[model samples]
Target: MIWLLLLLSAILGAIAFVAGRRLATRRAVGQSAHSRPGYHGAYAMIWALAPALLVVIVLLVFGGPVKNTMMESGSPAAVSALEPFEREAFLADAERVAAGAEPLQIWEGELAPALRSEGARAHRIESTISGAGVLAVVLLGLLGGLIALSRLRPNLRARNRVEGWIFGLLFACAAVAIITTIGIIASLAWDSFRFFQAVPIAEFLFGTQWSPQIAIRADQVGSSGAFGAVPLFAGTFLIMLIAMAVAAPIGLMSAIYLSEYAGSLTRAVVKPVLEVLAGVPTVVYGFFAALTVGPTLRVAFNDLGALLAGGPLDGIGQYLMLVQNQMALTAGGVMGIMLIPFVSSLSDDILNAVPQSLRDGSYAMGATQSETIARVLMPAALPGVAGALLLAVSRAIGETMIVTMAAGLAANLTLNPLDTVTTVTVQIVTLLTGDQEFDSAKTLSAFGLGLTLFAATLVLNIVAQRIVKAYREQYD
Candidate 1:
């Protein structure tokens, strides 16, 4: 019904716009107007639609509450005698009975006939109110259109007014974005404060242990939880390092080749093919890591370990024997594959944006293509490239699905890529999964992890911005 009202309002506004244009055109047949016919039409349309829409929105928002109040006031003495909560439930049943649906809870006695009577009365009142609201909207819209049409003259500044409105709208959108970011940060900080009160901030930030389990009863085994987050941070850092190590060179090289070396046809074909990797869901990459890469790595490492077990390098072999299917190496390598398109696409755009004159000048100086690209192009595009890599690192650090699937959730404080490990994001998910009491340290710990992650990402962004600004200034 609301959508129908809006549609009718739009049609009425359009008709008014056409009528306003005709009026302005007839007036202009005698003398030149200050603005175009379209501007006069738009001015009329805005006047006609804006107030009518605003009124309709208000009516729609408040209509239900008003209807409920009227129904409760008209409700029978028996119905009103019920408790407040029970009265609400009884009204719900009455509404159902009025609508001809079977009442789920309310059945039997004088309640049934009384509810039916009240429900029918409420429905009739709602219909009457709705009809009046629509009539009021139409009248207001017509009044606004008539006023705007009468005011339209040779000197009216409709175009300027319209442009100002548009500018204000755009500014409002930007303000909304800024406000939303502040809201998110404020929420995280508040919950993190609550969490810190329960667990020491020093222990969370600096302790090496990563256990988060808090037993409800002292008799429970392994319930003495440790909240040291160092291991999770270390694991996160190690995986991000491995992912970047794989992504940076390959993605950058691919971007360079696509932009500088590949022919038009090859660039068109190869760029999209590489970008297709980006569209492939992370869960698919997770599956690839878990089912294919993880197993392959484990078997290869185990075989290599067995082959070297009798040799002088026995200790290294023994270490290799402990390599598992799900480990940091598997997750990081797969995650790197997922990040390639982000790096390649951003780097390609940045490299392409470099002034053609710069490359021409470098070539004119008797520098070879390789030398020109290595020294001039790379330096000029370094800032954008740095920004892209920073984004990728942030992405890598926050990834949960690939880490959860490819890397086992053992919060081991080790640097070895072959051993199972977990990231802060993975731990955060684990800590909050399923039914949880928010007051418990176990659940609140997720907020702590999230706040820490947000802080770390913010710091990285700030540092990257400074570096990019420096390089960009030098190049410019």
Candidate 2:
């Protein structure tokens, strides 16, 4: 009913606005208001909508807290022991009673009379208050719109006021999105801070070991695992380096080919095909990395060396063995393949956006395509390309599934691509994957890892944005 009323008010207000505009005359009206008749109508429309919307928004923000407070104030012991299912059942029975309907039969059979009666009373009050609030907002919206319309005059600047209001609304809405992000970051930071209090910050940061195991029982264990995070960082960086090595060249080259060399038909077919890679599930990629790519790489390394020395492969086999299993090479290589389209597609857009006039000038100078591209286009598009690479790096750094599946869990401190290492993300996932007590250092450690990851990403993003801005200035 409230929604229906709001709709009616809007329709009526619009009609009245149109009527006023049609009646407006240049000379007949004694004095013109701030804006013309049409703007006045819009002003009325805004006035009509804003109040009710504000009321609804305020109610939504407070509704949960209000309900919780009411429930808490009533008596904690009453509902504290009730299981989730029982509490829900109790609430439903109360609602029916509050509505003046006969109590549910099950309530009479299972619950005590006093408890059921109290619940029913609470439900009735909450429902009545909510219903009345909605009705009031709807009526007020119509009343506000009507009053604003009557006050609308040729001298009034309704259009300016409305535009100001529109901009304010937009700013407010944007602020909400920013505030939400800040809120999430704050929550994670707080959790991480608590974990830091339990575990020394220096050990978490600098210790090469990372064992986030907690004793489950007093009688069961001699010592729990350490929470040194060094290995996780080493593993993540190793894999990222590998991924960047592969993705940077392949993705950038693909972008170059598409933007500068590929024919339209080839581009039409190939671009979409490449993007399909992105749509593939990360889990699928994980399995492919662990099962398919890892083994294949091991075999390929051996074969290449053997091929190079078929008759007398003296040191070939030895070299091949060095690059095998749980190494940075395999994870990086696979991740690069996954990230190729991300880098290429973004790079292509930036490259394509480089002004056509610059290309024309280069061509007029008798410069070859390669020369023009290398000297002029690349310089111009460097910022955008740089931004794309940074974004790709961000993606690589945060990647979880592939590393979790292929990168060995053992956080080896070795920097060699062939040695297995773990990442901060993988450690985080492992730490909190199971049921955990909130206060335990093991679970809280996940938050610390999260805060680190968040900080890294934030820094990278800021750098990327700055680079992109500089690139934009080159054209201007």
Candidate 3:
């Protein structure tokens, strides 16, 4: 029915457009016109379509609630007498039956007859509402089209008015994005506040432990759930640092070589191949880390450890032999591999964007390609390169699948990349994995972790932006 109304609205708008253009042509037969006939046609189309669309939107938003109210008002006594949850279930079943679907659950206490009565009433109510909605659409479209036609004249600035509408539409899209971001932050903060009420902020922020397993029942044996997030933070940073260490130099150098030295054929082939890494799924990297890299590192280190045992570097040997399959290093390395394309692509673009005049000046000064890149081009592109690196860092911090599959879920606080560690994102997923009540600290703590992660990332971005702005000011 909604789709049908939309088609009718489009047809009516087309008719209005044709009528408006014809009238404008007649009016401008001997006189100058402010706007073209096409503009007048578009103006009429907007009037016809906008009003009808507004009506349809109102129906879509309020139609369900109004129908539900009608059902509740006419609900059988048996349904009203049920508890709140049960009453909602009964109404849902009646709605299902109204749609010719069987009730999901059996009912008692004369509810069966009540269900049929309410169902039939619901069907009739929906039919009436849909019929009224169609009528309203047609009436509104006709009225708006008539008013638009009557207002049409050689002096009407229809083009400007249409442009105003388009500008308003663009502004509305931007406003929606801003509003959505604010809403997400508000929800995270509110839930995080509730969690902080249950767990002390000082402990959560400063304490070293992060065991967040709260007891389900009062009498249950449980750990009381330590919400200290230091371990998670440490794990997150350790992995990110390792990833950046691997990705930054290699990715940057690859960008430099490709941008400054590679021939067009080589650049065309190599750049695409490197970027294909970005398209590879993170899970595949996780599998590679777990199955190939992790065991290889462990075995290689263990063999070296065996050779060093009872020797001068016995302690180092033991530590090396203790390397595990699921470690921060494995996840970080694979994540770095995954991040190569982002760094390379962004840096390549930024470097290429540097004015060729800079390169020519360096060459005129007898500077070689390496010297030119190191001194002139790099400094100019630093702001964009920094931004790209920060973007990659944010990506690394938010990653979950790679960490979950490669790094074990042990919230260890140590800095050793070879040890099993878990990030805040991994813990957030673990905390909210199964069926659980939301009010508990255990569940709410996911929001806390999320909020903290958000704040950290936000701060990182602000710092990066400042750095970019400060450096960019000089160049600008």
Please name the candidate that would achieve the greatest TM-score relative to the true structure.
Answer: 3
Where is model 1 more than 4 Å wrong at Cα? 59-133, 216-225, 473-476
RMSD, every candidate, angstroms: 3.2, 5.1, 2.9
Q: All candidates' TM-scores?
A: 0.88, 0.78, 0.90
What's model 3's lDDT at 185?
Answer: 98
User: Which has the better lDDT: candidate 2, or candidate 3?
Assistant: 3
Give the residue spans of candidate 2 off by over 4 A: 1-38, 64-89, 92-127, 215-225, 294-330, 416-420, 462-476
Using lDDT as the yardstick, the better of models 1 and 2 is 1
182-210, model 3: which lDDT tens digit per residue?
A: 99999999999999999999989998978
- Quantify all predictions' global Cα lDDT against the true fold: 0.88, 0.78, 0.91
Over the stretch 372-441, how does candidate 2's per-residue lDDT look in tens digits?
9999998988988998899899999999888877777887887887667778888888887877788888
lDDT of 1: 0.88
Please say which candidate is ahead in lDDT: 1 or 3.
3
Error of 2 at 322 (Å): 12
Clashes, model 3: 0
Please list all clashing residue pairs in model 1, or write none if there are none: none
Report the Cα lDDT for residue 185, model 2.
95
- Of models 1 and 2, which has the larger TM-score? 1
